[model samples]
Target: MMRVKNFAHSTFATTNHQTMADAQALLQKADKKAASGGGGGFSRFFGGGTTNYEDAAELYIQAANAFKLQRMSKEAGQSFEKAAAMQLKTDEKDDAPNTLVEAYKVYRKTDPEDAARVMESAIQMYTAKGNFRRAATNKSDLAGLYELELSDIPKALEAYDVAGEWFSGDQAEALANKAWLKVGELAALQEDYARAIARFEDVARSSVSNNLTRYSVKEYFFKAGLCHIASGDLVATKRAFDTYLNLDPGFMSTREFELLQDIVTAIESADQELFTEKVFGYDQLSKLDKWKTTLLLKIKNGIEDEPDLT
Candidate 1:
């Protein structure tokens, strides 16, 4: 950014139109390289990759700025569009759904309705590529973008359901967490708790996932416990809460600790709730186990951040 500012200052100070134009050209080249998945990374230590949209976006964005600097709005529009297309590639879907989100960033002048068309194009591209995971995820994302910015909830749900179909294994956990956490507040929203619980249980039960306290696992246990409690299935509730405690025991403040005791006192009746709920406990109903990673087989993927768009 400092370099950019310095270059701008130098370019604008020059009386020679030709020199100014040349400077602009260099900037354009850099942008083009960035859009083309070239140039240096965004953050050198954790920089650009072909799989990331930033690399592709930087290129086309540079091209757009070049056109804009030259007072070529039409040409700039074209570059922005090109950037959008490049960003929407199936492999780069993780970065953000280019068809909608990326396009909005680059082509802010475009109508929201038009953006919907672009999103549709992205969905089609995903589907055509035969990457069901991306297709479903992007479709759901587009639906969300549409609903939020365009007041189109029905369309949004449709997109979410489309994504739901592909939400199996890792995909399933991802989608269910999204459904549970983000849309959980929506009264009209309906989550297939049975299916989602199964997916969460898959993660909870799997030996593959390690001791990480990720939101995914947390949501899984939390939602399972909530579902059991809602159904009055004390045993299932206890089990779910037990799993929760197993995952995160440190949340037991003194008051919460006593609550666990009260719930445990009724463990017998609670066990009976198992007949109704197929789960255990009246609480997420026990003291947390304080880092069950101690006993579990932990695989270290070493991924720290939850990722922005994922």
Candidate 2:
């Protein structure tokens, strides 16, 4: 067993060293090709001599792959960035954005800021090319990196909002709704209930016309109601609830509607226990997600924050 282990370790070390050397060699050749400013002797003779960015880009990609094989994510990401730049300089503008996406995927594992930066470049390229769908998709990804990786809530919210608009303009209502949901959830986290409520209401209104999304209208209105409750506007909450019922008449029969009604009643009476009970009861039947739980807690806290008339 010891002999076999020793052989395996030797083989692994040899392979790793060879891979490193190969990557270095490829990188050096790529640099030389980029600086040469001429394709080759034959191309010069044919009057077609020019900077060989195409070859340089391929070499950079190969080096990036080699770095990835060695688990050098940062190096791999940098190589991919170079490849993307080279592709942009060549006639391969279409491929440059994809190369940047490759860079983003690698950078996200090691450096979120770098990932966000490259993703923005990819999004800009896609938009410039009139590929709003791809741009919107990357914007959503960029928002996730900001929200989850960097914890930049404001930037995340902005990115999600832009993505939602782009998706809506592209007629990708489902994707737009998904992005808007994130915007609403984050806005609520920031105590921007008006923004949250508006986003949710917009989604609900848009969804009511689409058979595929109509079923989710109730959930969106429920969320908007929760935001209104959190904002301590019972009158507006009641008004919004009435509007929701009118918009989706079937919502009045849902457990979500019941919970909202019960919570509104509990808040009016300053009954925290009743609020908790209503939420708990609804949770037992239908599990509340983190966003819902958070907003519910905020609404519950508003009860205690309210001044006692007595």
Pick by TM-score: which candidate is best?
2
- Candidate 1, position 140, lDDT: 67
Residue 248, candidate 1: alpha-carbon lDDT: 57
| Deviating ranges (above 4 Å) for candidate 2 | 38-51
Structure candidate 2, residue pairs in collision: none
| Model 1 C-alpha lDDT per residue in residues 172-259, reported as the tens digit of each score | 6556445434333221223344544554455444422544434345444544444343344467667766665665564333334333
Query: Candidate 1: global Cα-lDDT?
Result: 0.49
Worst 10 residues of 1 by lDDT: 294-303
TM-score of each: 0.39, 0.94
- TM-score, prediction 2: 0.94
